[model samples]
Target: MRAIQITEFGGPEVLQVSDVPEPVAGDGQVLIKVDRAGINYADTHQVENSYLSKTELPLIPGGEVVGHTEDGRRVVALVGSGGYAEQAVAHAPYAWDVPEGVTDGQALALVLQGTTAWHLLKTSTHLQPGESVLVHAGAGGVGSLAVQLAKLWGAGRVIATASTEEKRKQVLDLGADAAIDGTPEGLKDRILEANGGKPVDIVLEMVGGRTFDESFAALGRFGRLVTFGAASRQSAAPIDSSRLMKGSKTIAGFWLADCFANPQLLGGPLTELFDLTAGGKLRPIVGGEYALSDVASAHEDLRARRTVGKLLLDPTR
Candidate 1:
């Protein structure tokens, strides 16, 4: 089997393609002939040795995949790592059968972001109907889905932040009530204007550092903010307990990888997301596709923020 491996942590060039032995399915795992893999900022973190969890050397950094079983059943899963290869293994409990109407790319795109967005709204924030939500990186993988799911989950208003105008427009098309420029400067005011001079009820924030500060400041009383990712690779400033107490606001964090420790909470939301896609209520936008050997370029583009929507690796391409 051919796979991309990072013998050492560094940049895109470290992702080298090499021939390796095909992995066999374990007791409760299934060997999947990987067709597509999803690239995420977390993958970059692993490659750079900055992930929250310690990773072993000579690691395969991919986190999600959509592929086929021995009997040719189509499936998608959050296969922790080793997904950027021709074959990988997935725990049977977390692997889902791809339903009628979802493509490999679409299913792969949802493996992490979809499930994260689903839990961010339904579980973390306990989002209420008619509440407002502001999602950062509104055109990226998780942000795109978060914007739509916020609407479907009954948010009265869905506000999104994107880096470019075209990306902002895409977020609007995805059911966001409004889109704002995602610049660190004047971010809170822009969100305030987008919200008709009101703070929001729920915020799905990924960008860390100053962006996290602004997003927290833009919340209304009793507002809940879920910090999921730090794409900027910068640390957010410490929170002041007094500010949170004054507004009765709450701040929470989520990591999909951590949730894997408890497989019990995994399948139900993903099944619901697939059903939404099958019914045309949801769409996981695929912005870029790269060949297995071009994994380096995929990492470059994604790290440089040169793409919108979910990025996929076509192992057979």
Candidate 2:
């Protein structure tokens, strides 16, 4: 089988496509014949040694794969490694049936982002109907899904922040009540005005750095701020206790990989996410597809911010 192996961490150039032994399913695991494997910032971070765990070199960096088992059942699997190959191994318990009407690429796109969005909504924050919410990176993988979920879950005003006019329009088309430019300091004010002077009850923050403090300032009394990623590549900021004390704000962080390690807590959100997609309440946006051989280019595009929405790597290619 062919796979993209990251032998050393540096740049996308380090990702090389080479032949590797086909993976075999262990007793409690299943082998997924790879179709499309999702590419995320986590994969990029892992390759650069920025992931929470120190990664072992020569690693296959993909996480979620949409494909079939030996028996020909359509499924989405969350695997440890080898997703950037022709065949990958996944724990049986982590393999989920793909929805009947969903395409393989769509199914693959949803696994990581969908689960994260669901957990962010149902676990990280409590949004009441008629309350406003703000989501950063609103056109990116998790942001797009987060906007849809917030709307479906009955958020009265859903504000999405995007870098470009095109991305801002994309989120509006996906059901965001209002789309604002993420750059300007006026974003918080725009959100505030859109909600009729009510501060946002929940903030789904993926962009850290300057945006983090701005998000904190935009929260209403007793509001929740959920940080899922630091797309801005900024250092962690020290929390201002005075701001929390003044506004009754709460800060929470979520990492899906860590959450998955605790199944007892992850099970509910995982199952609910799948159910939402299967029922047509949530949709996955697979914006780009690339051959596995193009792994380096894919990572380059991701790092350069040249791509939008979810990216998938076709391992069979």
Candidate 3:
């Protein structure tokens, strides 16, 4: 089997394609014939040795994938690592069968981002119907799914923030009531104006740093802000407890792995998420697809922020 390996932590060029022995299923693990893999900012961060977790040398950096399990069932799961390859293994407990009618690419796109957004909405914030939500990076992988799921959950108003005009349009088309161009200045004002001068109830803060502070200022009384990823590629800002006290607001951190560890708490939302997609309430946006050998280019595109929506790397492409 062939895989994309990062022998050293560095830039995109460090991701080289090479042949490797195939993996076999262990007692409870299932070996998957990988079809599509999702590329996230964390994957690129791992390559640059900037992520929260320690990188294993000669590592395969992909986190989420969709493919066929040993028994020929279509499935998707968070592999922790080793997904950027022709084949990989998934723990049977975490792996779920991809339902009929969902394409391999679409299922792969939704697995990670869909689960993240689902958990963020239902668990971290305990979002209520008819409440307002502000989703950052509204055109990116998780952001796109978050916007759609917010609306599906009966949110009265969904406001999304994008860094570019193109992303703004894309977010709006994905059912966001409003999509604001999140610049250094006037973004909060624009968001408030679009929401009829009302503050938001829940905020999905993916872009930390300066934008994170702006998100803090844009909240309503007793609102909640959940931070999942730092796509800003800069230092995160210090939190002022006093500032949070002013609005009686709350700040929380979220990661799928953390939620997955407590399955009893996550079981409900995970079911709802897959049901929403199966029922046609949510659809994933696939922006680009690359072969496993083009792993370098995939990282380059994600790191440069040139790609929109979910990026999938097909081992068979």
Scored by lDDT, the top model is: 1
Q: Could you estimate the TM-score for every candidate?
A: 0.97, 0.94, 0.95
Q: Considering TM-score, which of the candidate structures 1 and 2 is the better prediction for this target?
A: 1
Better of 1 and 3 by lDDT: 1
TM-score of structure candidate 2: 0.94
* Best TM-score among the predictions, by candidate number: 1
In the range 1-317, model 2's lDDT, one tens digit per residue, is 88988778977888999888888777999988888898997788888888767889779888889888999998888897778888899888788887677778767767778778878888889777876889888888888889998999889889998888998889999999888888746666777776777788999997788788777878999899999887777855687689788888899999888776665454456567667777787777888999998888898888776677799998877
lDDT per residue as tens, model 3, 9-59: 899989888888887878888888888888887898889888877887989
Worst 10 residues of 1 by lDDT: 257-266
Candidate 2: worst-modelled 10 consecutive residues by lDDT:
262-271
> Candidate 2: where is the Cα deviation over 4 Å?
184-187, 262-271
Q: Each candidate: how many clashes?
A: 0, 0, 0
